[model samples]
Target: MSIQLRPTRPADIPFVYETEHAAENRPFLLPWTEERHRQALAHPDIRHLIVEETETGRAVGYVIIAGLTNPHGSIELMRITISAKGKGYGRQVLRQVKRWAFEEQQAHRLWLDVKEANQRALNLYLSEGFVIEGKLRECLKTGERYESLLILSMLSSEYRD
Candidate 1:
């Protein structure tokens, strides 16, 4: 099946909330509240894109690009979920999002932080052209223990799309 990404609409909230609230997604969230999601969905600098399954037109994934103004623009990928992980869809969605950010948003650089233990995500980011910039030691408290954070980035010129 093919996938198409487009600007997210208010009507897409339920899908967004459902995908984000899944138990399996708890580890990746940034302790976001409902109000945060509301505000982010409406924010101008925050580019929110929804990946739609072409045949059904249902949102299968979403990505939020935040902090878009500076020349060294850093976009925190607020969230990205594909119902099922380990599939190739996540990579495709990320590439499409990066293309949109570079070609449409005119971003100079893109950056994101991943937990050190999230090897899958780290691998995805690296394979997608993001290089490790630094590691923030014990930056996030997942539960009772704090986890190290890996900072990754890519320049506009480095992006193929």
Candidate 2:
């Protein structure tokens, strides 16, 4: 199925909320409140996008791009969540994001951090041309414990397109 990214609407918040807190996805991400999603939607610097299956118009995933409003030419891929995994959707979404960040946004650098144990996602990022810059140790609190994250990034000079 063909996938598309669209500007997230207010109505999409419920789905975003549910997806972020979904049992499978929760471990890899920090929990976000509905109000936080709302705030992101309202922020000029942030881009909250809904990833949809074009043919069925079903919302399958979401991605958040932050730090766009700055003049530093750097953008942080704050979050990416695919409700349905292992179907190659995440790869397609990452390709689209790279295109948008480099070709459209004209960004110099695009970066993201992934949980160290998320081998699937780490592999995906590596395959997508992101280089592991470093590791942030015990930087995020998941609940009762803190976890380390691997910082990965791609620069415009290194973008294939």
Candidate 3:
């Protein structure tokens, strides 16, 4: 849970794309193309970051945050994809992201939507202090199947640590 977040470079896109498309992550979130990742890298309102091991400097995952320009101080936790699951890296990354969004970015609220079936991530989010807001019933069609998402958020005033 002590991973480091570094600014993502062009070369990082392949890993990011691959991670997004990984079988472990594919069911939980939508996958983006390499070109889309590249475009996001150049977007002012977006922050594309690589999550690495603190001591080894090995990249384990990536995170995307958006709405930096939101006048209302609300930010989106766009995506988080860790190549390996059950390693506590996701929680580490979530904690880091909370600090960045609330303390560094001065965001009043940070929110994310997760697939309803992603119980692991949903449990993580709830345990980390994000409150359930609502549910988007069948909002996305990944393939022949439709998926619903649960929206969760945390207010800056509710932040801890």
Query: For all the candidates, what are their Cα RMSDs to the real structure?
Result: 2.1, 1.1, 1.3
C-alpha-based local distance difference test score of model 2? 0.93
Instruction: Sort the predicted structures by lDDT, highest score first.
Output: 2, 3, 1
The collision pairs in model 3 are: none
Alpha-carbon TM-score of each model against the true structure = 0.87, 0.96, 0.96
TM-score of 2: 0.96
lDDT of 3 by residue, 20-113 (tens): 9888888887788899899999999999999999988889999999999999999999998999678899999999999988889889999999
Which candidate achieves the best lDDT against the true structure? 2
Candidate 3: list runs displaced more than 4 Å: none
Question: Which residues of candidate 1, in runs, are more than 4 Å off?
Answer: 71-75
In candidate 1, what are the lDDT values of residues 24-73, reduced to their tens digit? 77676664665666787778778777888778886787787787765565
lDDT, model 3, position 135: 97
Model 2 scores worst on lDDT over the 10 consecutive residues at 138-147
Compute the lDDT of residue 152 as modeled in candidate 2: 97
Candidate 3 TM-score, true structure as reference:
0.96
Please report how far candidate 1 places residue 132 from its true position, in Å: 0.5
